[model samples]
Target: MKQWKPAASALLAFSLLLAGCSSEQDAVSKPPATQNKQEKPSQPANAAAGSETSKEIPDAVKKPLKIAAIVQLSIGTFSSQYAQGLKEQVNEFGGDVQIYNADNDLSKMASYVENAVSQKVDGILLDHGRADALAPSVKKAVEAGIPVVAFDSDLNIPGVTVIDQDDYSLAWNSLRTLAQDLNGKGEIVYVWVGGFTPMERRNVIYEAFKKRYPNIKEVARFGNASQNTALDTQSQMEALLQKYPNKGDIDAVFAPWDEFAKGAARAIKQAGRDEIKVYGIDLSDEDLQLIQEKNSPWTATAATDPADVAKLQVRFLYQKVAGEETPQIYSVQPHLVQKSALPEQKVSMNDIGKYVEGWGKSDAAISAWMETLSKEQKK
Candidate 1:
């Protein structure tokens, strides 16, 4: 990435713009009806239209806006994908983003936030950390006038903007599919691990599921896939299968995250229980392969293209720093993927980019900004 430095004139102009622009410019201004809901459109966003850059093309934008992306639990592929989006979006907008992995350690995450503040970075993107532990430092950064956008963290701090995967909708869409598959009555096993904000939000829907469909009995609810999540979950699935050897005892498995769903599918396959179906949240090339496999128990999922999600987050922060309006809470909407929807040929996550159609790009505040950039480039 090229290094960016602002000219004195550019800095002065940007300061003026920031002072005058309204918050509406930084927000998801009157998103379409389907946005924020669980509904997936038959057609995806138009990738061919391309993402636009900010209009006006302030000289300050030519100066790279330095941002620190502090992430919690950089262990899994999903996290890696999310980071990919962040880096790609910042680079697209001529900004430099340095990602600080917290490794799921609260203290490290807290310290990273403080360090960003001390360094006086242009902005900070907090990814997947506990709000309780990081709120104090987040408050300090916001009070200091540093724009902060959090992804998957339930930080209720007044000034900070929050962007999430719409966890409740993601869960509802996937679980709802599973329920329909079972005709609303069956024995199901829920694989989940608590502590993370996204998971907690999904749990809220899980509790709601119990209330809404009392006929669906949750035979077993236990999972601890923290360190080696995939392997650990596979082991847990094996144990669950042993406890309920009779195939008829369990009709379906609800593993909100793909890792758990993969494990459960493997265990069911090994146990010759192909009858059990697995539904989950989040999808990737690997997850798609499992779903497409013949006789595979992994059925369907609700997900957002992680790369698109990351870019949206970066754009939100960029808009904030650019003196544009932003929203308090933005939901990167999800789409449902069933086994029938999988492509016949083997493909990677990147291949799905065209199909997902930029993952609802126009609904994002950044889309409007990008439109200005496109027109400017044409000039």
Candidate 2:
């Protein structure tokens, strides 16, 4: 066994352990199948590698590395998938991770960071949240010589590496695909939930869309403010449809995320308007299902692989901790998937689940997949 120095502060440890135990309880209470399947594959390979690697650590640094993970939310499928991936990778590396949730509360996040510092963990992984609110605590960790890695969030802080999606490009590509489907000229109703990083990035992409396609007019814009507020989005869309009753008045609907797109689709279904095409981001199982169903309003979506982002963050953090050179910022590219592309193929949550579940069964297969992905990125 290798002993290593703990990097977190005392308070950080207690809060993290308490929160982690609570989360573990919730995880234990859920049916195994219901738990996000995205994390399963990476666990076995990383865990086995980690166990073997631990033996390489000299007795001088024999302590286990303690890591604290802070996430923006605890319940969503996207967040859950990211968490699962992070955990699997950490376990694979032969380390322990204590998870914490801010529940979108900035103050709780600040406190969580403080707690992790007190607990004296070796490192901390931060998900989406306010970077400024965490600055003081993160600075303290850096001053104390603990490495901090941020994922799915932008923290313009020193000594913290950020691994996140290329949201601007993703939004632009998704909208472009929608525009191409509409043949460049159409009235689009853009629905968005503001404040989140993805939404902010989408705003930039929306601006680019205006420049790229001069004829595509944004007839209406709705802001829901909550990520999972489907009812609010649907209500907004219904109002828009009523206001613009003429089928020729609106050509398409664009949403910043899948939930918003789903909301728009629901509104279109209720209105009995199948002519309006819909587009959004985050290609989760549900979004793919909507695309597969013929006569559905959802025609396309931009795919952001949360599991891949999580894995990149873990790998980058490992390099940083190992004193190897790493990029200060890593951006994961999003893919555009269309309904027509999946002719005979079906898309389901089970498909995503199968990919993640398979990782635990074979390290060679996962490694091969990762290598292919890397090669694609280079191209």
Candidate 3:
């Protein structure tokens, strides 16, 4: 399909340049859910869509459209894959894309947004940032006629389009499975974070879940970090285990993010508490392995294909940049994945496409738009 290959020299140069900007954060090199540079790159579900070249590539798409892709963190595999998708799609479409890693630094995020406006980039892709800090820059971009597409960002700007993983559904599906597994009666720990859009949305459901399952007691609550995520959470989980040492005291855990789930699972395993099950949101090749393991406490998760979401965000940006009518707010749906349903072997992002059907395809409008572009090629 559409091939987007980054220039080796340019990537290397960018890496070197970025090296000085922020200290290298430790990357959690674990799998069934995270990224490994050595693993084979899996084709996306919509790979076929890229095979046919448009006979008439839009002049806007043909010219190397400059894009400023900014992210909150690069330490985790999910975030990395998300960033990777944006870069690859832009490159494949013959566009110039520069990724700005904020390392989850709020001030840095603001700086990048302001810099993008100053640079007069054709478009800006804001990934997982706070709206309060980004509003001014976003307003500047809109005033300058620059399109900005936000993924999991809380920015409430008038012109910018906001896209997000259906956080409520992701939590509802996973928690429903957990409630069923527990027969709706158990003491569970709640691990969550505030400030991020996706987390905030999921929290809404978390509150609803508590109200619905009145018997499921939330004995404890926790949060996550933008750096050394898994490890930090694991350490936090260890402390939690110590506080609630009795097996019967903590029957289950609801860690909405995979990283938090992973940490909770690791802590449970280390404490030799196999009976306590952990449910989470988000999955990857790395995450699948953990679920497939014998006696693994991580029982289930809900997720969308991060790679697919990333690529789709880029496509949306392209369409908007080309004056296509897209929804002001686009939501990607998620699915529940239990441990029993996981493949024995580690699964890549490609394999996940089946579970999350139409992972990146937002609506019929997107497909119809593509069809129009295809017919234009013939004309």
Candidate 4:
């Protein structure tokens, strides 16, 4: 074979390099630019394992827990409304709430508290029941690591939180309205049902009225009576009216609740004293209807939003159970509602009485009221 020249070998080497580069370019150009479907490799094993672990944990275990509510009485529009509110809020927050009604029996309330403790409830919401009566049970539960929250009625006991209405303010404002309506002077007959929070509020109102309005005289102080016992309230009212025959002297009658006001209204009507102004606490739909009907002399009422109070109490309890910080006491503001302030159409007793029965009978009416209430709240 003839010996190859150095220049020829170098040129051959250059040609081979060019051929390799051209082949690579052709391979790249062969695939469609828009049709490339290559997938990037997945995350490393450690990161993938961590993500899987995170997803396996259940939310219930990671988040807050259950609550139990104890109520004083099973009946009445205010209590029922509050219970409904509490239930709705608890359901919304992904928590369990069990409500127990003591039926106005203190012993029953104590038993319910004990039962709740034994059940290992994460928290408790006490409504309109004496704190002192349930203190032992509450203390035991707290020692067992469960928290207690009180609403409407408070014990002022340590380690227990209270959420309540400004009773003193409510009393002051209500009496002031009565005084103004009576033109700064009148003989006022006061009636109140004893037990729970209202009794305390009644006492406050009486004291404040005496101090603030020397012109307003207390014509009568009636004892504790159930709201449903209209006969008893009527008897008491009649007795007072008989004692003070001159209707001109009695300018107003003050009742602590709507039902009591109803009794007073019946007595006032029977006595034919339409000029006497009637004022009371609680603006239950029944009372609202009474106000709207204009049949009764119930001109104004000092109203506390029990539903809002219940919701706030439940929210505070939820935070405590969830290991979140919250206020020791949450106060619900009260309003003074007059009949004139209500809607122009004026709902009838026949229509609103259906709602006063605890959202049980009339679904449509309850829904409408709830919607209206929601709108009012937003405003």
lDDT, each prediction: 0.73, 0.64, 0.71, 0.61
For residues 1-379, what per-residue lDDT tens digits would candidate 1 score against the true structure?
0001111222233234343221222222123343323212221232111224535654545467899999888756777788888887777676789999887788899999999999999999998999789999999999999999989887867657687776766777888898889998999999999988888777866776776788999999877646578778888888888888886799999999877887888888888898899999898767877777878988888888887778878877776776655656656667777776667776667666445433444245444555554454445
Q: How far in Å is the alpha carbon of 66 misplaced in model 3?
A: 1.3
lDDT of candidate 3 over 82-178, digit per residue (tens): 7777877676666788999898787898899899999999999988888788888789899998988888876666557676675656777788888
Tens digits of per-residue lDDT, candidate 4, 1-379, equal 0011221332243234345433432332122333322211132212211112222323332344578899887545666677887887666555678898887887889888899889898889998787668778878887887878888675655456666555544555567788888777878888876676755655644564576568878877784545355567777888888888885878898877666777788888888888787887765555666677655687777766566567767655654554433434434455667766556566632343333322112111011122322343345
What TM-score goes with each of the models? 0.81, 0.73, 0.80, 0.71
Could you say which candidate leads in TM-score? 1
Candidate 2 lDDT by residue in tens digits, 1-379: 0000011121133234345423432321122443224223224433312222322433312244688888776544666677888887766656678889887787898889888889887888888776667788888988887788887565656567665565655676688788888898989998876556657656755765676688999999886645456677888889989999988888899887777887888889879898898988876666676667767888877766666567667665654565434434444545567776665577564354343222111121122223332343345
- In the order shown, the candidates' Cα RMSDs to the true structure are 11.2, 14.3, 13.5, 27.9
On TM-score, who's better, 3 or 4? 3
Total clashes for model 1:
9
In terms of lDDT, the poorest run of 10 residues in model 2 is 1-10
* lDDT value, residue 34 of candidate 3: 32
Could you tally the backbone clashes for each prediction? 9, 25, 14, 0
How many backbone clashes can be found in candidate 3? 14
Q: Model 4 reaches what TM-score against the true structure?
A: 0.71
How would the candidate models be sorted by lDDT, starting from the highest? 1, 3, 2, 4
Off by over 4 Å in 1: 1-54, 350-363, 367-379
